[model samples]
Target chain A: MTLTAKSITKNYKTRRRQVSVIYDGDITAKSGELTVISGRSGSGKTTLLSILGGLTKPSGGSVFYDENDIYSMSDDKLSRYRNAEIGFVPQGQGALSALTVFENLILPASLSGSKAKDRAEKLLERLGLSQLRDAYPRELSGGELRRLSVARALINSPSVIFADEPTNDLDDENSELVLQLLKEQAQGGAAVVIVSHEQAALKYADVTYRMDSGRLQREEK
Target chain B: MNINTLMLKNLIKRPLRTGVLVLTAALMTAAMFGGQAAAKSMRNGLDSLEQRLGADIIALPEEAQAKTDLENILLQGTPGYFYMNKQVADRIAAIDGVEKLSAQYFLVSANAECCTTKVQIIGFDEESDFTVKPWLKNTYSGRLGDNEILIGSELSTKVGSTLSLYGVECKTVGKLEETGTGLDTAVYATNETVQGLIKASQEKGIAVLSKHDPEEVISSVYIKVKDGFDINDVLSEINQTIDGVQAVRTKSMITGTADKLTVFSKGIGIVTIAACIISAVIMTAVFSALAGGRRREFAVLRTVGFSRKRLSSLVLSESFTVCLAGALLGLFLAGVAVFPFGRVIEKSTGLPYLSPDIGAAAGYAAFAAVAVILTGALSSAWAAYRLSHADTGSILREGD
Candidate 1:
C-alpha cells in the first residue's frame, strides 16, 4: 500500500492577517519503507504530518491511502480508519496522566472494542516497560514515557505509523531504541513516517526528504 | 482502558472538584424536595381540617371573641373556656335557618394533681351532638357511659387504658381518627361524665372549678343550616338574634387558612426555584473550568479515534452519576427532617400539616432525582461540546 499527498496547502488566519504555512507540499510512503522528513523549527514538518495523518484539514489537498481519499471519508469512518490502520506517537509527553503505562498501551485497541491484553503485555515487555506497567505517566522517567508512547502505537499493529519528534527529551540510548523500533515496524511491512531532527534517525530511513520554508525536497541518499 | 474506566479515573483523580459538584446538586435537590413536601403536608392538613369540621356555623360566648384564641383552641388543642347559659343551644335551635344545634362544655386539666398530662376536655351531649359523635363512632360504636372517655388519636393512650382526672378514674373506651387539627389532641366524654368530674373538683376544694356551674353553662354551640337555605343569611340571622354570643361561618375560617397557605406555598416555590437556578449556574461554571483543564486529555482521546459523540456521552455520564448520588442523599436528608417532626412543623407554622403517605413521598423523591439528574446533564452539555469539538491537532501541540 502507498500513501500519497498531492498539492497540499495550509493557511492560518489571524485577526490582522492571513499567514501561509504550507505551499504545495508533497510526499509519499510505500509499504515496507521508513520515510523521514527532517527540518528546523517552524518549517511546517509537524503540520504536514498532521495533514497526512488525517487530523487537520488542509486548505487545499487530497491524501490517498492506496485508492481511498482519507479526507473524503465521513467523520466516523475516518475515526475508524485512524483507530485500526494508522498509529500516532505524538511529541512531548503524550501518555495520558490519568492512566497507567499498560492502560495507555491498550487504549488504541480498546477504542475499537478489543482488549488486546496479550499484545499490550508483549509490547510492554519489548519496550522494557514491564516493570513499570502499573505506574502512571507522572511516575515514569522521560525516556520511559517516550517508550510507552512508542509501545502504544505498535499495540494495534497499525498498517501506517506517524511519529512526531518521538525522541524528544530522550538520551542517546533511548533515542536509538525508539528509532530501531520504527525500523523494525517498517521491516515487518508497515509504512512508517518519522518527522524529527535527530541525526541518528537518518540511518534507518529508506527514503528521506528535507522540509524548508513550507517546501518539501527529495534528499540525496 | 475502556471509556467508562477512563471517565471514572478522571473523576476519582480530582476528588475535590467532584465533591463540589456533588454537593451543589445535593443542595438543589434538598431545597426542592423539602419545599414540595412541606407544601403538600400543609395542603393535606387543610383538607383534613375541612373534613373534620362538620359544622357550618359556630356560636361562642362574647368573651371568647378573641379569634386567634378560638382558632388555637380548635386547631392546636389549647385548652380554653368561656361559658354562656345552656339556654343558648335552645335559642339557636329555635332560629328558623338552624337545622340542628348542639352545645359543648370545655374543661382544662391544667395543674390537676390527679392527671399526669394536660389536655383539653370536651363534653358533648351525645343525643344532640352532630359533629364529635360521628367521629367518635369510627372507633367506638356503643354509647359513651359515665366516667368512660375517648382519647384523641395523637394521645399515646390505648383503648383499654384508664385515665384519672380530679380523683376520678375514667376508662379509656375508644380513640378518635386523626383530623390533622387541634381536635386530634382533645379528650372527649359524655356531658354527664364531665359534670361528674366538675363535681369531684369542687368537692375537692378547687376554687377555680366553683366559678362556673357545670349544669347551667355551655362553652360553644355548633349549628347546621337546613338544605336550600342561604348560609350567609342564616349566619346573619343567628348573629343578629343571639344575645351575648357571636356566630362565625366556618367558610370564612377556611378561607383565612387557605390565604395563609397560598402565601406559604409561594414562598416555598420561590426558594426552590432560586436554589435550582443557583446550582445550575455553579455547575455550568465548574464543568467549564474542568473542561478547560482537560482539553488536552480530551484531545488525546480524540487522537485515539473516539468520536465526538462518545466524548460528549462520557462527560454526561460522569455528571449523571454524581447527580444521582446527590439526589438520593438529599431525599434521605429531607425525609429525616420532614417526616418524624411533622407535628412540630405543623404547630410551628400554626397551620394544618399532614405528611404525605409513604407511596406519595417516594414518588416525590423519584421526581426530584430525575429532575436533578437532568439539570446536571444540561449543565455539563456545554463542557461536553467544547471538549468534543476542540481542535485536536492544536490542543496536542498547545505547549510544544
Candidate 2:
C-alpha cells in the first residue's frame, strides 16, 4: 500500500487573526521505503504529518491510501479504517499513564477486537521492553516510553506508520535504536513516515524532505 | 484488557478525585434513606397512638384539669392522682349517643419502695372497658385475677414477673404491644388490685388517694360514642350535663405530639432536599474537572481508534460503577443507624421513632440507589459529550 498527500493546507484561527500553518504540502510514502520530513520547531512538520495520517482535517487537498480518499469516509468508518490499517506514534509521553507498557502495546489491536498478545510479546522482546511489560508509564524513563510508543504503533501491523519526533528526548544510543526499528519496519514492507528535526535520521531515510515556513522542499541526498 | 479494566485503571490513577466523588454520593444516599425511614417511623407511631386511644371523649375532674395539662399527662406519662365521685360514670352513661363507658382509677409508685421503677398505674373496669381488653385478649384468654396485671411492651418487666406496687404484689399476665406513646410505659390492672394498692399506700402513709376512698372515687371516665353520632356533639352534651368534670375528645388529645412530628418531618424533608442539591452540584463540578484533566488521555484513546460512542460508554460505565458502590455503602450505613440504634434518634428528638419494616427499608434503599446513579450519570453526560466531540489533534498537540 502507498500513502499519498497532495496540496494539503492547515489554518489556525486565533482571536486576532487566522494563521496558516501548512501551505500546499505534497508527499508520498511507498511500501518498503522510509520517508523523512525534517523541519525547525513551529514549521508545521507535526501538523503536516497529522494531516497526512488523518489525525487532523486539512483546510484543502486530500490524503489517499492507494486511491481511497481518507477524508471522504465517515467519522465512524474513518476511525475503523485507522484502527485496522493506520498506525500513529505521537510525540512526548504518548503512552497512557494509567496502563502498563504491555497494555499500551496491545491497545490498538484490542480496539479492533483482535487478539494480539503473541504479537505484543514478540514486540516487547524485539524492543528490549520485556522486563517493563508490567511497569506503568509513570515508572518508565523517556527512552523506555519512546520505545513503548513505537511498539504500540506497530502492534496492529498497519500498512502505513506515521511517527512524530520519536527521538526528541532520547539519548544518542536510544535514538539510534528507535531509528533502526523504524528502518526495519520499512524493510519489512510497511510505509514508514517520520517527522523530526534530527539530521542523524537522514542516514536511514530513503527519501528526505525539508519543511520551512509551512512549505516542503525535496533534498537531494 | 476490557473496557471495565480500562475504566478502573483510569479511576485508580486519580485516587483523590475518585474518593471525593464516591464520598459525596455516599453521604447523599445516607441522608435520603435515613430521613425517609425516620419520617415513616414517626407517621407509624402516630397512627398506633391514635388506634390505642380509641376513646371519643375522656372526662376528668375539673380540679384535675386545673392542676395538670391532660395532654401532657397522656403524652409524657406524668403521674396523676386526682379523683371525682364514682357516680360520674353513671352520669356520663346517661348521656345521649353514648355507646360504651368505662371508669379508670389512677395511682403512682414511689421510687424503689412500691415497684421496681417509678411508673404510673392504671385500673380498668374490665367488664365495662373496651380499649385494653380487646388488645389483652390476643395474649391472655382468662380474665385478670385480683393480683394479676398487664405491663406495656416498653417496660423492662416481662410476663409472669411479680411487680410490687405500694406493698401489693401482682403477677404480670401479659405484655402489651408497642404503641410509641405514653401508654407503652403504663401498667394495667383490675380495680380490685388498684384498691388493694390504695389501701396499702394509705397504710404506708403515701397518701396517693385524694380522700383515701378507693371504693367511692374514680380518676377519669372513657366513653365511646355511637357510630352515626358526631363526637363533638357527644363531647358537648357530656360537658354540659356533667357538673364538675371537663371532657376532651381523644382525637384532640395528641395535638402537641402531632405538631412536633410535623415540624420534624418537614425539617428532615428540607435537609434531604438540600443534600440532594449539594450532591448534584458537587458531582457536576467533579465530572467537569475530570473531563478537563483527562482531555489528552481521551484524545489518545480516540486517536488509537476508539469511536466517539465507545468513549462515551466508557465514561458512563465508570460513573455507574462508582455510584452503585457508593449507594450500597450508604444504604448499609443507614440501616445500621436506623435498625439497631433507633432509640438514639427517638431520645434525641424527644418523640416516638420506630424503624420501618424490612420491605420499607429495602424500598428506600432501592430508591436511593436509582436516584444517585441517575444524578451521577446525568451530571457526567455533558462532560462525556464534550470529550466525544473534542478535537483529537489539538488535544494531542496540547499534551503535557
Candidate 3:
C-alpha cells in the first residue's frame, strides 16, 4: 500500500495566541522504498509524520492509504486499521517502563489479539535483545531500549512503519543498526517513513525530503 | 499481554502507591462493615429483650419498686427478694382491660450450704402461670412436679443436675432459651417448691424475705392487656385502684436501652459517612495523579491501536482489582472485630450487643464490597475520561 498526505495543515491554540505548525504539507511513501524526512527541531517534521501515521488528525487535509481516506473511518475502525496495518516508533524513551523487554516487544500483537511469541523471539534474536528479554526498561541502556521499541513496532508485520527519530538517543553504532533495520523492512516490501534531523540517516534513504516552516521540499539524492 | 496482566504489572511496579490504595479501600470497607454489624447486633439484642419480657405492664409493690431496679432485676440478672400482699393480683385481674395476670414469687439464695450459687429463684403458680410454662411445653409433657425445676440457659448446671436451693435439692427438668438478659441467671419452679425453699431458708437461719407470711405474699405480677385497650389507661388504672403497688409499661422499660443503641448507631453512621467522604476524595486525587503521571504510557497504548474505551477499561480494571482486594481485607478485619471481640465492644459501648447472625453478616459483607468497589470506580472514572480524551500527539510530545 502507498501512504499519501495532501495539503495537510495543523494549528495549535496556545493561551497567548494560535500557532500554525504545518501548512500545505504533501508527502508520499510507497512500499519497497525508505522515505526520510529531515528538519531542524520544531520545524513540524514530527507533526507531519504524526498526521501521516494517523496518530493525530490534520486540521485541513486528508491522508489516504491506497484508495481509502484514513480520517474518514470511524475512530474504532481507525484504531483497528492502525493496529493491523500501521506501526509507530516514537522518539526517545518510548518503551513502557513498567513492562519488560519481551512484554513491550509483544504489545502491538497483543493488542491485535494475535499470538506473537514466535515473532517476538525472532525479533529479539535479530536485534540482539534475546538476553534482555526479562529486563525492564529501567534496566536497559539507551541503545537497547531503542531496539526494543523498534522490535515492538515490527511485531505485527505492519504494512507501513512510521518511525519518528528512532535513533535520537543511540550511539553511532546503534544508530547505524536501527537505520539498517528500517532499510531492511522497506526492502521486504513495507513502506518505511523515518522522521529525523540526523545527517547520517540520509545515506540509507531511497528518497529524502527537508521540512522548513511546515513546507516540504524534495532533496535530490 | 492480557489487560489483567498489564494492569497487575503497572500496580506492582509502584508497590508503595498500590499499598496505599489498598489500605484506603480496606479502611473504608472495614468502617462500613464493622459499624453495620455492631448496629445490627444491638438491634437484635433489643428485639430479644422485648420478646422475652412479653408483658405489657408489670405491677409490683411500691416499696419493692423502690428497693429493686426493675431493669436490673429483669434485664441484668441481679437477684432480689421482695414481697407484697398476694391479694394485689386478684385486684389487678379485676381491673378493666386486664386480659391475663400471673403473680410470681421472688427469692434470692445466699452463698451457703443451702445454695449451689447466688441465684434468683422465681416461683410460678402452675394453674395460673402463663410466662414460664409456655416455654417449657416444648420439652415437658405436663406441669412441673414439686421437686422439678427449669434453669436458665446461662446456668452452669445442665439438665438432670440437682440444684440445692434453700436447703432443698430440686431436680433440673429443662433449660430456657437464651435472652441475653438477667433472666438467664434465674431458676423457675412450682410455687410448692418455692414454699418449701422458703420454709427451709427460715429454718436454716437464712431469712430471705422480710415478711413472715409466705401464703399471703407475692413479689411481682405480670399483666397482659386485651387488644384495643390503651396500655397507658391500664397502667393508670392499676396504679390508682391498687393500694401499695405501682404499675410500669414494659415498653417504657426499654426506652433507656433503646436510646443508648440509637446514639451508638448514629455515631457509627456519622463515622461511616466521614470515612466514605475521605476515601472518595483521596482515591480521586490519587487516580488523577496516576493518570497524569502515565500520560505518555496511555498515548503509546493509543498509538498502538487501543481505543479510548479500551484505555478506560484498563484504568477501571486496575481500580477494580485494588478495591476488591481492599474489600476482602476489610471484611476479614471486620470479622475479627465483631466475632472474637464482641464482649469488649459491648463493655466499652455500654450496650447489650449480641453477635450478628451469620447470614446477616454475609449480606453486610457483600454490601460493603459492592460499596467499596463503586467508590473506587467513581473516583477513577473522571481520570480515565480525561486521559482517554487527551490528544495522543500532545501526550506523546510530553515526553520530549
Candidate 4:
C-alpha cells in the first residue's frame, strides 16, 4: 500500500488567535521503501505524520491509501483502518504503564480480537526485550522502553509504519537495532515512514524530505 | 490484551483511587438499603398490628391513662393493669353501633414463686371473644380447659409445661404467633382460671384487689362496630352514655405510632437521597480527575485503534465492577443490622417492626445492587465522554 498526502494544512485555534501550523504539505510513502522526513523541532514534522497516519484530521487536505481517501471515512471506520493498516510510534513513552511489556506489545492486535502471542514472543526476542516481557513499563530502562515501543508498532505487521523519532532516547547500538528493524520492515514490502533529526537515519532512507516552516521539500538522493 | 484485562489492570495499578470509588459506592448503597429495609420493617409491623387488633374500639376504666401507660403496655411490653366494675361492659353493650362486645380481665403478676420477671396476665371469656381466640386457634383447636394457659411467642415456656401463678398451677397449652407488639409478652387464659388465681392471691396474703371479688370487676372491653356504622360516632356515644368507663378507638391508639412511622420514613428518604447525590457528585469529580490524569494514556490507546465507544465501555466496566463489589458489601452490612436485632429496634423506637420475608428481601437486594451500579456508571459517564473525545494528536504531540 502507498500513503499519499496532498496539499495538507493545519491551524491551531486558541482564545487569542489562530496559528497556522502546516501549509501545502505534500509527501508520499510507497511500498518497499523507507521515507524519511527530517527537520528542526518546530517545523511541524509530527503533525504531517499524524495526518498521514490518520491519528489527526487535516484542516484542508486529503490523504489516500492507494485509491481510498481515509479522512472521508467515519471515526469508527477510520479507527479500524488505522488498526489494520497503519502502525504509529508516537514521540516519547507510548507504552501503557498498566500493562506488562508483552501485553503492551500485542495490544493493537488484541484490539481486533486476534491473538498474536507467538508473534509477540518473536518480536520480543528480536528487540532484545525477552527477559523483560513480564516487567512493567515503569520498571524498564529508557532504551528498553524505546525498543518495546518499536516492537509494539510492528506487532500487527501493519502495511504502513509511522515512527516519530523512534530512536529518541536510545544509545548507538539500540538506535542501529531499531533502524535495522524499520529497514527490514520496508524490505518486507511495508511503506515505512520515519520522522527524525538524527544524522544516523540518512544512510537507510530510500527517499528523504525536509520540513522547513511547515512546508515539505524533497531532496535528491 | 483484552478490554477486561486492561480494565482490571488499570484498577489494580491505582489502589487508592479504586478504594475510594468502591467505598463511595458502598456508602451510597448502604444508606439506601438500610433506610429502605427499616421503612419496610415499619410497614410490615403496622400491617401486623392492624391484623392482630380485631376490635375497632376498646373501653377501659376512666383512670387507665391511655396515652402514657396503655401505649407503653401495648407497644413496648411494659406490663400494667387497671380495673373497673364489670357492669361497665353491659353499659357499653347497649351503646349505639356496638355490634359485638368481649370483656377481658387484666392483672399484673408479681415476681412470685413461678417466674423471675413480672408478666401481664389476660383473662378472656372464650364464648364472647373475637380477637385473641382467632389467632390462638392456629396452635390449639380444643377449648382451653380450666387451669390451662396459652403463652405469647416471646415467652420461653414450652408447651405442656406448667406455670404457677399466685399459688395456682396452670398448664401451658399453646404459644401465640409473633405479632411484634407488646402483647407478645402476655399470658392468656380463661376468666375462670383468673378468678381462681385472684382467690389464690387473696389466700396467699397478697394485697392485690383484696376488697373486691374477681367476678365483680373486669379490666377492659373490646368492641366491634357493625358494618356501615362509623367507628368514631360509636366511640363518642360509648364515652358519652357510659359512666365510669372511657371508650377509645383502636386507630386513635395507633395514630401516634403511624405518624411517627411516616416521619421516620420521610427522614430516611431524605437522608438516602442526599447520601446518593453526594456520593454521585464525589465520584463524578474523582473520575473526571482520573480521566484527566490519564489523558495521554487514552490518546495512546486511541492510536492503537480504540474507538470512542470502546473507551467509554472500558470506563463503564471499571465503574460497574467497583459498584457491584460495594453494593454486596453494603447489603451485607445493612442486613446484619436490620435482620438479627429487629426486636431491639422495635423496643427502642417503641413501635412495631417486622422484617420482610425472604423473597421480598432478595428482591430489594437485587434492586439496590442495580441502582447503585447505574448511579456509578452515570457519574462516570462525563469522564468517559471527555476521555474518548480528547484530541489524540495534540496530547501525543505535547510530549515532543
Candidate 2 lDDT, B1-400, residue by residue in tens: 7645888987787788888888888888998998898888877777877787778888898874633544544555556667888899998999889999999888777777644657878899989988786766245878889989988766878788898887778899998877766667788999888988888888888867745489998888889999999999999998888898988888777676789999999999999999999999999999999899888888878778887888898899888888887798888887888767655666576566556778988898899889999999998999999988887777778843
Which candidate leads in DockQ?
4
- In the order shown, the candidates' DockQ scores are 0.62, 0.58, 0.64, 0.68
Docking class of 2: medium
Writing each residue's lDDT as its tens digit, candidate 2 over A132-191 gives: 989998888888888898889998988899898988788898789889989998999999
Candidate 3's residue-wise lDDT over B267-342, tens digit each?
9999999998999899999999999988888988887888888889999999999999999999999889887775
Q: Candidate 4 lDDT, tens digit per residue, B132-194? A: 878773458889999898887878888999998997889999888888787888899999988
**Superposed Cα RMSD, model 4:** 2.6
Per-model lDDT: 0.85, 0.84, 0.85, 0.88
Fnat of the models, one by one? 0.51, 0.49, 0.58, 0.59
- Docking quality tier of model 1: medium
Relative to the true structure, candidate 4 reaches a TM of 0.93
Of 2 and 3, the candidate ranking higher by DockQ: 3
Error of 4 at B238 (Å): 2.3
RMSD of each: 2.5, 2.9, 3.4, 2.6
* Ten-residue region with minimum lDDT total, candidate 3 chain B: B64-73
Chain A: TM-score in each candidate? Answer: 0.97, 0.97, 0.97, 0.98
lDDT score at residue B205, model 2, on the 0-100 scale: 85
Winner on lDDT between 2 and 4 is 4
For model 1, give the TM-score of chain B: 0.93
The 10-residue segment with the lowest total lDDT in model 1 chain A: A89-98
Clashing pairs in 2: none
Residue B39 in model 1: lDDT: 91
